[model samples]
Target chain A: MALQPFTVHRGVAAPLLRINVDTDAIIPSREMKRVSKQGLAAGLFAIWRYTEPGGREPDLNFVLNKPQYRNASILLSGANFGCGSSREHAVWALNEFGIRAIIAPSFGRIFYHNCTRNGILPIELEAAVVHYLAEAIQAAPQQNKLLVDLPNQQVSVAELKFSFTIEATPKRMLVEGLDPIAMTLEMTEQINAFELQHRQRMPWL
Target chain B: MAKTLFEKLWQSHLVEQLDGDAALIYIDRILLHERTGSIALKSLAAADRQVRNPDEVFCVIDHIVDTLPGRGDETMMPSGKEFIQTTRSAAQSAGIHLFDIDHPKQGIVHVVSPEQGIVQPGSTLVCPDSHTCSQGALAALAWGIGSSEAEHALATKTLRINKPQSMRINFEGQLGTGVTAKDMILYLIAQYSAAGSAGTVIEFAGEAVRNLSIEGRLTLCNMAVEFSAFTGLIAADKKTIDYLGGRPYAPSGENWKQAVRYWQSLHSDAGAVFDREITIDCAAIEPMITWGNSPEHSCPITGTVPKIDSANKKSASMQRAQDYMGVKPGQKLAGLPIDGAFIGSCTNSRISDLRTAAEILRGRTVAANVRAICVPGSTPVKHQAEAEGLDKIFIQAGFEWRESGCSMCFYAGGESFGFQQRVATTTNRNFESRQGPQTRSHLASPATVAASALAGQLTDPRTTQKS
Candidate 1:
């Protein structure tokens, strides 16, 4: 249940150019009926990738279906990626499908939180930079492997270097592989103190 | 200090102020559904973590269960029964209260929360389901989160979240006839695309908004997610307190008085600043319906489906939605033939929704060409409808009278209409194949669904003739 450490991720980047890529399309609701987190690897983008019920035949036109992008580990998506649905399965699907880092202009708030918790590094970059990277990836996916260095907060491809910003807590968590609950537990005293004040200030029922 | 309603509730519940924007906020209540909440609890159990406060948690089996009468642990979906059974075991193990399929009070988590008075004004609640924001209608701070967050809340009774910026959407003027809260929300989504309110919690103000019933307010907040807002809130007032008074789980005696006094204070102070503000004239709105996959791809019922201008077809999704919907430019939204009609889902399956549908279906019959289904939102709503003979009207009109649960809201490989069946439905979310494979669903109000069922097409509810 603990997250994998994310330090320096280098892999081929696949471009999903569509904006507002909702969690449903990432992995539809029907595929999420499984209660356990296991068996989720196949459900990642099942609708877009699978031509049949169990993904017997791959959809050739889909990016993931292309042989070159089959093992891509970096996803260069358009703005507002992972919108709609609070399902963490979206992040699970992305991670299970071999995507370690996602570079987008923006992300849904819940999806961004889930990405952090699930150990999938979400890099928020400028729209123009994301668009440029997406084109670069699509043009030469095999030759252009993106190097996402979390400690340095930089992503580089061939000759282009883009610096990104992430909050301190999430950055440290990703770099050190620290558990979020463990971090929160360290502030138990502060939490209890606040509760004591809150209850005394306003206690009705 | 002047404070907006959001800030008042937020500061009241703030537990540990973390670095920058993040904080550890305490949660008063949590409502869990069978679909996603079960996964969170199961993972916690697997991790050997204990629920911090079982009394604060309430679980219900709504999402994956069959809505058919005389149903049990069996499910139509492949291993769908596992999700329900797993949740039953997980809730029991966690010592959290479970509302099983046979529980009289069981219903959609959002409907059951306020209906039972468990979600009081000024409270903060979260659920794994996105529509958890519906509880915000009662002036509560509620929003959706992922299963992992649910697990954390179960284990800690707190969530570490960055406080969102605030926005106020004021609906001024008066609502016209035949336009309900569903229409108002649809109109809002059409005006502001789905992502308009991203990273913000919206507080709806203005006279027209306050004029809506509590149920209508619930319906209004139900689609806040469609606008990409973290949640939607309305300040609690006399109506909210009166609505909560004497409910099953509401406070009694001295507690009731103190709770009411506190809830009465849960309003935005004058001159409180918000990050953004917008105003909509309610009189300018009309009964609206979705024409494409996205909720924003909508228009007034009388308006035509838009053909994207040649210069405006840049967003492939818009063009793709129009093509998938099979509606051309200049196509009339009304009178488009439908093969089925659904009248349920947490979005619009409350008692008022059933009554509205019954009014349109009093003596009429569903078209022979259309398959009409009506699933009540909750067991209590179903019982109340039956007591009032609303069920008789629907049954007499040939609508399938179903038990309470999320039936075909989004077919989880379970019971569904025929493939590619063009249907008008009351459920939210018009995404491609949401209800069933290739199913073309036109999102509308319950009355619109009823009238459409009768006409075997998308007919304006206001224009439906009396039998």
Candidate 2:
């Protein structure tokens, strides 16, 4: 479960202004046939990415279809992004689609955790700041490239800058590229202490 | 300090706080399904990790298991048998209880949890599937976790999670005919949009929720994930007590009395504070159905597609949904011809749901042009429906009555509706390609699905009188 350490990410930011952008939209159930996270890059935003007649061809109007956004490595999203399903594949799809970070006002709680676990930095900023980033991207597409600094926990669009906050554990995990399982088991003594007491009182559970 | 029902559950389950709002919480029970659990179990084995407490964990062959009657180790999904076989072997090696395909109790994870009484009030449960929150209807704290979190909980008996904010939705008045808990939840999601409950644990309160049957409550809570909520729950009450009484996994004798007393206290205090609150009148609800991809794209069955205007904040999503569903603003959802109808899912495949649909389908025949199918939520539910002749009623109505599992609700290379077919179904999600690629899924209650099949269109069930 070791994820690639995230130090600094700088790339063109694609703007998706919709709120409550669900994981199902990121990657739908039909594309979940492969248990592993393989071949998910094509399924990213499949609904919007695919043209109607069986989705054989890409939809030209989609942001990713546009030449400028073809290399988008960062996503600027509205509030409550990644809002449904606990599928970690949503993060996998985004990673495989070349998105290294997401800047949003807020995020679905589980999706936020999943993103952090998978080394996809989900920077939570104010709604106004997110809007500024989206507008900045729209104003000068090529000049709108942004940088996400995981160690410092900050995101910047040229001179415009916004600092972000993530917990110490996830921050360290991202910096160290270590899965939390081994670290989580560090408190087994406390965990075992509670379980033994709980089992005695509620054996049926 | 007065505590919300959710707070009490969280406080009792707290093992250690990691940092800030994040805490290492003990999971009393862990339920796993073939899709996600197999991956976790295989990973656990690969890592040389053993389940911390095998007796407290259980796994079922749902999600990837074919619902076809004669289905065994074979799966409709190519290479899907590996998931089932891997899970079976992993569960055996881990010493975790396995509800195999032929296990009498084998069923959808959510349905099996409640039916087997594995979810008790005041307990904290986690499953790798989103609808695990359905068990919260029993007054327990249950929510979905990813495969990685499942592996962590299996190995350490605890998970590191940041506590969610709290919301309480109060419903007053009485429900009208054709209005069920499914309609109530759909109405909530529609009114507030799917993200309304995001990052919050929801407590469904007020007279309307209290009056619902245990099955109805489960049906309502089952869709908690649809609203982007952490989970949904109700306070333990007499109905919950009665439902859990005498089940195979429930405590007996003096332990049972003590358990009941403890559950009785697992409710919100009078002055418990909630971060958000919403009020709804139950009598105002109507049979609901989704007209488009997202569950938020739902309306009363009698209404037309919303005219997306400046007033609608979700105008962009609505427009996309309209195009994806091939509907225009002000388009009527009713009388729209459908090529298929599906009645089943963790959301609404319980015995009561089956009986409710059967009452409408008795002696009725599905339209020749529409293909309809019914899947019970669990093997026990299937058996109970057959005992009551519901299977016969469905067969007579030309609806295929299939074995219990998560079938057709999600197409992970299993049986599916016609490609790009418009199907009216009783399922939790209507995301594009959820049932099949290019498929247009209109979500509704089981009765609506059954009625739509008979008319070969998305007909409102309230219009059709019971047989």
Best by DockQ: 1
TM-score per candidate:
0.97, 0.95
Pairs in steric clash, model 1: none
Error of 2 at B32 (Å): 0.9
- The clash count of every prediction, one per candidate, is 0, 0
Model 1 spans with C-alpha error above 4 angstroms: A53-55, A196-205
Instruction: Point to the candidate with the largest TM-score.
Output: 1
Compose the digit string of candidate 2's lDDT tens values, residues B1-467. 99999999999888888765578889999999888888788888889988998988989987878888798888887678878888898899999999999999999989998999999999999998878888889999999988888889999888888788999999998898888899999999999877778668999999999999999999899988788889999999999999999999988998898888889999999999999999998888999989987888899999999898966656877887788788888889999999999988899999999998999999999999998899999999999999999999999999998988999988765677856789999998887677877688999998898889999999989899888
lDDT (10s digit) by residue, model 2, range A70-148: 6999888877788767778888889988888898888877788788888888888876788788787787667678988
lDDT of 2: 0.86
